[model samples]
Target: MKRPSRRRLIAATGAAAASFSLAGCSSDSGNGDGTPTGTSEPTTDGTATQEPTTDDGTDTGGSGEPVGADQLARWVPVSDAFEFDVRAASYYDADLTALAEHESDFYTGTYGRVAQSLLGAELVDIVPPESREHVVQIVPAFTIVLRTSMSAGELATAVTDAGLSETGTQGDATIFEGAVNSTQSTVAVVEGVVVQSFGSNAQNAVETVLAARSGETARLLSNNGEVRTTVDAIGESELLVVAERPEDASSNDPSLDGAIALGYGWQFDADTSNITIGVTYTEGETAEPSALASYLTEQDAFSDYGNVGSSVEGRTVFVTGDIATNQFDLLSAGTPGESSSATDAPQVQIAFEFEDGTMTVSHDGGDSITASNLSLVVGDSPAGSQFADQYEEVTAGDSVSVDVSNVESGTNVLVLWSDGRNSQMLAQAQVP
Candidate 1:
């Protein structure tokens, strides 16, 4: 993991009432273990020595947000499965905001640099606010590790077992447990390929940071208890799709669904925008090349995007839009057939699946919203923000939008999903 920097980091905080912060980034490197000379694994007593803070001229405040161009390349081409990094930090700052900002800035910066290239959603922060501020001064042994072996279920279990769930006072310095969020791994799949990543905050805050690392120092930290790893192999003769199978739910896994929405904006049905959901399964798990068609039919969430599926797929296959709406133009919205230009406009949109569930949108202001009208452009950043400057600032709410378009700062977005594959809910945003 990276360190903090001495900079003016601030956010007026407005949007879907949901917002949090923390820090770190990525860099290009040939896999080299950087476990400190005497570093150990994390334990109840909080073992695992961290890499020494950059001594003034040494390495202080870690890397800046978003991540460097080089590093992004390294992490992406490296692997597809979820990864994690166990980072040990010397709580040296009392300003938890700075602590969170320190780390978030890095990831935010990462978005600017490699936003499109990012493979999965991310976690900007997760540690305890009080802890980030309290652990200053002491060179807490920092451990950086990564993983691609375990499923979301397993990862959650490990983090819990490691006692890294508490945001404070666990003596382990871990916050944002069960934080399932990422940028890249959010997609759909037929034979297996992470399809898409689900969960954003969890990734930047927990998983990605804990994923396999590079460089000598990275290895050392990974070896320590601070970081744990799990790996598995699908059959060469078949692809393995490891989806969540809940006994109580008719949809995929409610927990997994929520985790994906928060992280990747994944919606069900003909929802290409919300591809990052379910679980990390292999393509040839059984004998199905793409259970997607079959799965949708089974769930009854299938629909046509815009009557396009009619000329192709089959009587059963329909575009995501057609299944959920009377009108849909995905190609126009994302491909070259569309044309639009604006000043400082970012992506914003409320997405939802009627067959699946609804999502909620929370604003920074007193207003809390719930609609399927998510948009791609938001007005300004800082103290006061708005949905294209039309709606008032948001406090909290949800939407049925499974995925959203154009994500950026000062924008309020939300998903009010039912977490049921078989459930039906529409997403919308209320402006003006």
Candidate 2:
């Protein structure tokens, strides 16, 4: 198969946790740069860019607005050699094996979309870890809550404990020292807003990250934690929302000393589900216990990991199996050239239907559709097709449907379901 093009990479990168709209609900600040970089390159120059999707591990695809030199400097990881930025609650390598049951395909799958959306740019998830431990953990973005300084190792330890995913670790890893480190850190920026307890040293760490900017200039500092952590901040008016998760942690709230991480709560009903998260801050302080929960209760926000489905020809598609995660991620899906399966298979599939939009795999696979991830139907990319599937144009207000019957038994085929006639994508399926 052909290597994924840079534009496609942008979308894949941005899917992790870059849902810009939900971020706005929390109330912090900044104008959005409409740079369309995903599969559907903003055909209309800069004017027609849609909101960025959230799974390819990216936010929105597009060239971000030019940042200032100092701001750009802060973008670098704070370490002597940049490493992933790890905060108090993020998980580190050593702690990974312990948090396996707590993983969220939502974060992983969303990141995939993110990478695709932000194609061409050096991408980073502000996390660390090659693979994730399966544990129900929240993204550390809302909890890095850093206000102090720390070393690479120190941040690493802290991040491992904060989030159970790599994004948290990536942010902490930014503590590497030297040239190569700077270059890598420059690829992406992951900042934290900490609310440490009396014992957590988070205050110092947050300060360190923010302090990286010396009077608006980026600075690298070796903190008491023994590693150099770069510093930067998006100013106070910045409001960032943690990824929307299910309401499992509702009655369970966790806290730590010096600093504390928030647990999100998502509730599912017979036909619908919503979420409510607890923040670190409780009453007055920014990072206090039950802070997010209290805030969520007050605002009455909603969190739903929507249905997972794909589209082909010009209709929507659905993928089911032991299909716990990506609908399009069939183990045997391939591009134009490849005819064999590799260890890392493309199990996810894409389908367009009901409306003009895209549906991506949020989880690797789930026992059922109600527990997967997807975006509200946005516009469709006429050129969009699963791996090497064909695309057929859809007219506005058209009713379409997609469903996956089965993968070719022996070949591990990815049967793409569609409603269009005369398409080649279906022709490629290894049908029984």
Candidate 3:
């Protein structure tokens, strides 16, 4: 089988989390200076440190003061005890016109087009606070500076209009919060820059941005050595993601943190995408590339770990990969530890049909032995029907449909297929 490219792998798995739309049209040609050219304009200077001008052709904030690139870079805090720090920007300077061509495929139709209107840079810091016990918890804070045609207040209005509830205001920023798929998130817009955060440090993310804008001494990530090194290695790319295991990080899982640091960068072209990744291990730590691939495969963090080509240069491992545009979303379903089964598992076709407040689960292509132990499992807790030991005889080339009545809409249904000894997840479908 031909290995899938890195772009297809990321688009299939990382789209839900890492989808950030750029603002311009793209081209298939390169500018002779290594960097590819988009339809807007070609930029070869990767070291340009100028702040992007706002829509009104001004580089100043609402207060009429010039917004320095340093100020934009200093929003994310620099901490000694951090799990990771990631900073990404549009290829070479915040050229919205050039970046707009490299739009994310995650969002589609109207919402996708609207999201592409904003363009800017981002910095994220994942810090682990002190805890009493051996429990490990990481808090992530974000600082993003976006240049758009809309004003700060207008942007806040647009978010609120898009289903986010107004959660009052903090300092000069307006707050909005919402929940989706049991996960809650909060966003704060101040001075045309949006700061969004989720998880344990959601509140702190708002305060961090506010404090930084108020002239408070914010520990800037730009001052950190690890962040600078990773950014320098990234060179000219549309997106850069870096993860590091701090020296002081408690060893909750030594093997997982053995690779001290990781840097990944990607550049989107017209027909294909390019990716570069580097991984560094701790001093005296020796690990094979296959071992790292196994680790990522076990974690299921990436889909194309098996396809990733890795080589050692001194203490660091370097990987280069690419993907065509048409190869997205052609991988297996389900995530790791979430009922994932082997690809060559016994061939059985299962389908869920919901109608008239009833769910019908149909099974086919299984042998008589396989069907004798078939059972349906639903809900997370034992509060729902156990349906244990409820098996009916089914033979090969025959089909059976189990009708579950009175099922309410919006209920999460988890179906498990077992053959008395081994089990596999059949389907996870919601009532429409």
Candidate 4:
């Protein structure tokens, strides 16, 4: 397999998170320049003021609890040294483990694949369950910080076992440089955290994280007050993502142009799911929150989950809503790329039969769909008018007959499945 570039790395990870519609999501390594002394051409202009001191075991190591999402800002390179277009973070709350069991194929199969790709099979396996993860990007260079339970010694052994050679040690972190599963990687193994960087700019990316943690470089949180305020408001979540609207953003969406920064958080409470999305607008450019909230309610793809509401305070517009836990598939199925085995649209094989002036629609195969979600139309009549009663679930071999005695031959017949927000044609044919 060919080596995947840093840009593609972000794409794969973003797809896994199903982030396309969450907040205006974009991924690009900034103007590629400023290559520090390294193995390959660097694609980012991020610089670090200090290199980690040679290993001294005396310093307390990663033995403490994994870094929390609240402190992630400290690990981000200062804005002066790094010019990045986007940055986001993810945290897998312990409760997500239970939710994953309910949707194993999507949670484990789809999301786990992305994690394994970035962290290597060995390290991914050793990572503690429900470990939180963070990613900071500097255009073509990106750094991944993972909170793992493995000790520094245990992590070092895993890194070397995964085909990396010990290059040096930075304080309590052990640095390894090599190819893991065909991708050039620079990985650091400390007590409870493992910072990994990939692609051509791996070395500098890893070094940047170490520098930020050591306070050699100013952290993004300390330098950017707006981001800090937004982050503080959002706090911790199962999935927390934040991005600053770059001065040179190329997007043409009028609603997004005024955005100064966006903060999104997703959480689940047993049978209910809640999402909070906030957008900080520039001075005097804030859009009407009520109108935006109305638009979201009418266009919510997961409307079956619950209602969407909004509130505006100062420059920020907050959109909040809850979804039924059973409707979680709507989120997972939206994930793009081959890594996702499930689809947002229902996959059903339907067959239509005309006999004795009556039409029969049969579900031949494919995934089961809710009966209320299916709408049948005959000769332009209103949807579901012909059905006397609807089944709770429609699966293979299920069939419904509609009286078409008054309909003319060749009239159009259609079956559509909708989840309030979106719809798809399951089968269409002309009545005989």
Candidate 5:
């Protein structure tokens, strides 16, 4: 296969960001405990006042007091049967409050109110069964804590009222099962914390929560040295994700095989947002960092977007940077590797037609070519002057036209196309 150009790679990254954002929106709406639906106000009576620590030494429940990072860390299950493990957490109440100002529907009515009551959440992705080889089935297990004012029964009642059926009781907790987006998900409220499992058999979710309550499971992620180091590096970000690649896993991707662990941290402030991604490679996996960085830098998506900075520390590579709030949408537009679908042939051919100070550009093949943003670069110049820009939208079809009447004659013009995320050279033409 021919190597993908930098522009194509950047486009893929933007597409991935778009997908991730869409997924978040959907997940927020139907997310087991996070779903913005519930009434029957939580009563202070019978609420758990004491913060109980699980076998892994993490606090389980309470109001006002957020779960410590250590507690959040210990929640990730460590298992050898899986190829990799991921752990993530968020302060939903704060996050939702910030979002509600712009998206009123997110905080409207009872569901919205209930969603804002959520304090924090931790999620785990378990290995898929052998039967489901083609599909990456992540049996999601999550723990969500509400305000101390809510009791376990009240939380369970709210879930049941929303649409799920109360199947049975697991110990003192009530088990509610329902089909979400065609997948049967099970949820239970233990103490003041709501534990849920989705995208798997209902029983699997119940069992995982039961194991967690009984303190029978291992705290694999928090105890790992590499994970701890990465978490420390993240240092108090509002959102965090940790992924570990198994030592024995097979993959054609060099980044997966080269790195033992990966960490991503996102910190959102009023004016600016910062995101940092770090990868820890195995000893002597020196070539992997550059290979991965080179692969990423080559993509058009990142080249024109974000103030990204990278550094090497022994066997680890850290990429950290900040982007203004307004620039965020542009950086997360198209999906990654999306430009490749436009053509299977080796090179992208850009046909340009110039007419009386006007230039029209077109490309044939690929799934679809979208250029939300267009710019013109003069020959041998490092920076391009912006001529056109689009946001969260694509100009479908195969052609786009631009006016270049102001250009000097005989100057080489490079046309760049970007759908917020990635950019590619559309065509080069010389002014007649």
Candidate 6:
């Protein structure tokens, strides 16, 4: 990873002036009513009022209001199981539509086509595009909500038209189950909202989200003080991602060692896209702004693409980066370890699963590689050397299996990428 040039760092410092500024940081005080203290009241219209805009229309800092809480408040409370809470408000800002379109593959790949079916053209027509907001909470099992203008009958007609059938009902919510792109999913549709859950216990997940949305259960923004403070610090943006850091987050990188939560906010511009990466440190832990700035600048995606800047507010450290519109493609090239400069040894992430007597290796993401270029190298020679030659191309989600029952459980398995002349380890795992 290359360091940002001195000129670029200066440019980044100037850009950071216009990017998200820290309103305040690390306030755990909350009203007993579940609402975190320091948040503004919601507007009469259901949605929370946004921060005041500048003369040219960009959001100016210092309102101290948690701008996007209305959407986050519609989801279940952040718990041990909650991994990512994402809000995409393309309707509010047309700029986000382009950004979302560019990252469509990521959404569909991560959440699967179930997300596409719910957020596809059909529902977009029923929902008021300008005011519609999509919130996706991933606990590994997804709980998605689309704030819409469609009534119950209209939503039913749209979902039915999309080949979904009513599976059951929970209170005022109607649950529908169906397959999109051969993937099974279930969604709960209630007045002015469409909820979906993908993975096991879909119905139960939908119910949980509905309970949170109706204020029957705890809401994330109101109950989770850590997340509330982090989000407020990041302020408003077109896309916001709030992820709860793991308790045992021991990272080789010093900047991430004691991270408690991560808040990422992106605001698009006519010529560039500005991103703010905020990391909440554990209590009593402090962040080194210079180290954070250097660490973030080296991130593969942003390495040579833009200027990087950093600032510390209380226990939260915010690193802001700007990427030019022309260089935007680098952001989708996959993260550091998942990608490389080699053309023959394409970037790929493989997951190895040992079951019964077989070891299945699946391509989770990154570039697609020719079958002949990949080899399962266990010890010196893999159990099934012919596994790679069986398929013409191995793509994301594609899996190849080899008989590993004879191999010891403690042996190591490696997925090697090669074009005969050159070879590199794409992924490796210990036999378990």
Kindly indicate the candidate among 2 and 6 with the higher TM-score: 6
Predicted candidate 3 versus true structure: per-residue lDDT over 1-432, tens digit per residue: 111121122212211111211111001110111111111111212443333333422222222122222334334344321222222111112333333454443112211222221221111111011100010011123223443444677767766664568878877778887742233456677665565544334555556545544534223333334334444554565444444444443332333345555456556566565565656666577357665554444432245333566666655656655554222111222322232222223444555676665566555444343443444433221113322333445444443333445544433344443332123333344445
Clashing pairs in 3: 22-100, 23-100, 24-100, 24-101, 78-219
User: Candidate 2: what lDDT?
Assistant: 0.21
User: What is the C-alpha local distance difference test score of candidate 5?
Assistant: 0.39
The TM-score values for the models, in the order shown, are 0.22, 0.20, 0.43, 0.55, 0.48, 0.57
Worst 10 residues of 3 by lDDT: 127-136
lDDT of 4 by residue, 95-117 (tens): 22333444443333434433332
* Residue 281 in model 5: lDDT: 68
Model 5: per-residue lDDT, tens digit, 78-136?
A: 33212222222111112222333323221123222223222211111211111111111
User: Candidate order by TM-score, highest to lowest?
Assistant: 6, 4, 5, 3, 1, 2
Q: lDDT for each of the candidates? A: 0.20, 0.21, 0.37, 0.48, 0.39, 0.48
Measured by TM-score, how close is model 1 to the native structure?
0.22
- Give candidate 5's root-mean-square deviation (CA, Å): 18.2
Q: Candidate 1: which stretches are off by over 4 Å?
A: 1-211, 214-249, 252-334, 339-370, 374-432
Expressed as tens digits, the lDDT of each residue in 266-366 for candidate 6 is 66555666777777787777579878777766654456446778899988889888765434332333432343323334655666677898888888887
Q: What lDDT score goes with residue 169 in model 5?
A: 80
TM-score of model 3 vs. true structure: 0.43
lDDT of 3 at 192: 55
